[model samples]
Target: MFSVSIKASSIPMSEREPIQSSMQISRTTGQGGEACLLLTGSCTLSALGRRMGDLSDELASYASDPNLHWDLTKIDQMDDVGAVLLWRSWGGSRPEYLSIRPDQERLFSRLGKAPPLPSLPAREPLWIAVRIGGGAILLWEHLTSIVILAGQLLLDMKYLIAHPARIPWREISANLFRTGAQALGITALVGFLIGVVLSYLSSKQLQMFGADIFIINILGMSIIRELGPMLAAILVAGRSGSSMTAQLGVMRVNEELDALTVMGIPHSLRLVLPKVIGLGIAMPLVVMWTSAIALMGGMVVAELQLGLSYQFFLHNLPDAVPLANLWLGLSKGVVCGMIIALIACHFGLRIKSDTESLGIGTTNSVVTAITVVIIIDAIFAVIFSDVGIR
Candidate 1:
């Protein structure tokens, strides 16, 4: 059997005023050679009166013992703080041989039932199959939305055909100016540079064989049939497609589209149909203008580098390049314009009610329009490889 005693500096109830109280802690050996702590006097904030450093240190030494017991029968008064101190000394749980009055037992019971502190959520890595499946689902959702938008536009077109007066001619003209007329300067500038570079390079190779006159054939066929339509389409996709998406996205964010719906305005007819038709009408004209300007540039380079007269270049250009190639390029222009407008409207309608969504929708609209244009151009090349080539 062993023993340890701790005395506090507080005045005991009997030694001072009746309201004054003090605490004391003592240790003893229990049955079966276990260690025990006996808590006596008032075990409360006001009663303990001073910090129980000595008592806590005395108890801490026996913390590693598995058979430690606490006897709380002699506690005359206790509050939450006092209960918490003793509860912590017992490793936050009751010991096997604890002895406490019914009132003190209730204090410890409430502490034990308190909700635990919150912890951070665990981060788990996703399986490879789950990631791939999720991506496939998202791709399907986007494709379905695009198809629905196209069907709505088609229905609106039929309605307009029956009711010609309800057609939005004013909107169509405005979009034509924005998407096509405004883009002419950049398209012409790029086309002229492309023509000059192609002529210069072709002159170098044709001159080696003393066949400099064939620069007209190579330059006319390449620019009118392929480069002209492609340049116009790509420029429109970057400049005008992104604008359409941003405009619709802002309308969605501001709830303007909802207001239009409430006012009995069909969104597809008012917003999407005019833009598509306008671009379709304007794109062919842009292609023709770009091709004309590029041919003039090629003629200038041929006159300067190949010592070929402008008159000879012009007179032979029509005979050297077939008319079918010109028609093919204009046809590509009309199709590409409708495609760009459709892709823009598709992403625009998907924007959420936030500025971040507006930016993301615009970026996606431009990228997807350009990608579709290249894919379609490739398909056109493969299918018409024999038709336009001489």
Candidate 2:
């Protein structure tokens, strides 16, 4: 096969082709002493090319003279682009002194009837203050809702205490199995891996200082007093809290929440209270289990890296971390667990009957629960700083 070669032009776009432009404009004095703006040659897009801006500017200058005669009839071949340029130059209306052909007259008429473009509104000066106020109002609304729910729970709690038969033991048990029992495997794995990493890192620092035995104290105090509860709470917030919110959101979509309302069953009594009580009971046990698993992992790592025996690590654990620390960790679990459940239910109950609301509500529930858990942890750290650190 023989190939036909076509060499491309080496000339730059801005530098080439404008030299042979056909469209031209010139000013001439008319017989009546008025200036005549004459346009000639092919007044189309292909002909104008890079010289369009220059032509538009010259046309506008001639248009400014109200007494000037625009003679576009001289144009040899005019298209839509040429018509638009002429129309715009004449200030969206025909010049007082003008001459045009029938086809060109139609183009001007169409352009005259076309609507003007929409413009953007001016921005407000106090937009920042408005945004801040809106956010503060939303926060206050959420806080108020949460406080109302807590008070309702307290009243229901008193009622249940007096009439033990109406207690939602079955619902609480079901939630306990879901939030606590089903969560163990993942929590154990996470705790063990965390312990191993902490032990490995701490071993290096202790070994350098000739204080390898201090690994037990570091792991024991930190894991039992802080890390264990916080880790479990965060995991549960993302997992079970999201599940709870989504469950309620789905119920709202399916009209089950409405059905329950019509059937004389309160949402708090049947739904929210059980989840709160279940998580409250289950959280401490989970914290304890997590702490134990992490300690076991740390013990294994300490023995492997520092030549410390597992028996020695276990034996000195009680003396290294006080019993009060374990209790404090469990207490944090209880508070965080209830707070997570409350946040989840609050978001869930507010979900509208739509898939978009369901998705947004579930996401907000998990995020708010996790954030509230961290905040609770920080508060506990500050308040009980002197209680567990010894």
Candidate 3:
């Protein structure tokens, strides 16, 4: 005979019982006869409390058996909760050979009753629609503010032109130097790489067609007509536009703008005009620098890969790209810079008296500037295509 035994300790009546209780199980097997379970003492609420581990161990021993015979003959006391725990441990469904003492029949009956399950509330389609509609309204309001600001900028152009002296020259110069000169090194490196890539790619395709010499024309046209203006504008917009929005937003939140107005000072002339003029002057110069560096990069690539002389590359550049193309790039840079400054100022002025509004204004400036740049580029593309510039 093989047997295992476990004993549970008594729990206190005055104090609350622990969440789990211990139990002892004695198993006996004799001469290969069906294994027998001897469950003793009370695994009850008042006695053993909740002895889940003991019950689980007892059930696990009989898991591989085809038929389990439980001997509850010596149980002094049992409760409905204990009966339910046993029933759950034994695979839930009633076994055909379950043996319960006559005294514990009431406990078994209670365990058979099912507890009420929680009910889930039904979802309402109207509530979902209302939330979606509210979000749409908020988006529309933001878009409307952007449109009104653009309209106001257009109407103020005549006023700006007439009062050119009202623009703060010193502040404009400071901002131009900060936004343009500080970015020169990185812009030159990026422009150089772009030029090198264009030269190498064009050289390969041109060599295949026996037109390798025209690689200069390809680099010149691509840089002067498109890459130089677009790249410089994007870099300035990302750097200067965010800074302008953040600066104005801080002023708006701290009530400095209001204070300036109360002191009879023109906030627009002091703040907005300087930024607009600064960017307008700086952007074209940045574009010119970017174009020069890009051409140098292309010249280096041409010399290394296409066996072309640096002097030859420089000599062919003027004929390959016209002065008209350089002018077009400069005009694009000016327009893009004005758009970035205008959008940044407009969003900044819209900030509320909170940090959240400041963040929103800064983000809105970048998005608006980039969108305007793309739209203007598309317009230029259509115009240039019609004129047969390519």
Segments in model 3 whose C-alpha atoms lie over 4 Å from true places: 1-165, 386-390
Comparing 2 and 3 on TM-score, the stronger one: 2
In model 3, which residue pairs have backbone atoms overlapping below 3 Å?
Answer: 6-24, 6-25, 7-24, 21-50, 21-51
- Residues 1-390 of candidate 3 have per-residue lDDT tens digits of 111121222334443344333334677653458676767666676565455667566675564464756776556456776676677776665555556765466557666676657788767779889889988997788678767765655555566678876546788899889778887887798899999888888888888888878988888888988999988888888989999999999998899999999998666667876788788888898999998899888888888888999888888888888778888888999988877887788888888989988888899889889888989988998887644254
In terms of lDDT, which candidate is strongest?
Answer: 2
Q: State every prediction's TM-score relative to the real structure.
A: 0.69, 0.69, 0.63
What does candidate 2's lDDT look like per residue over 299-386, in tens digits? 9999999999988998898899889999999999999999999899999999999999999999999999998899999999898879
Model 3: weakest 10-residue lDDT segment is 1-10
Which segments of candidate 1 are over 4 A away from where they belong?
1-124
Off by over 4 Å in 2: 1-127
C-alpha lDDT of residue 335 in model 2? 94
lDDT of each: 0.85, 0.88, 0.77
Tens-digit lDDT string for candidate 1 (268-343): 9999998899999999888888888888888899999989999899899889999999999999999999999999
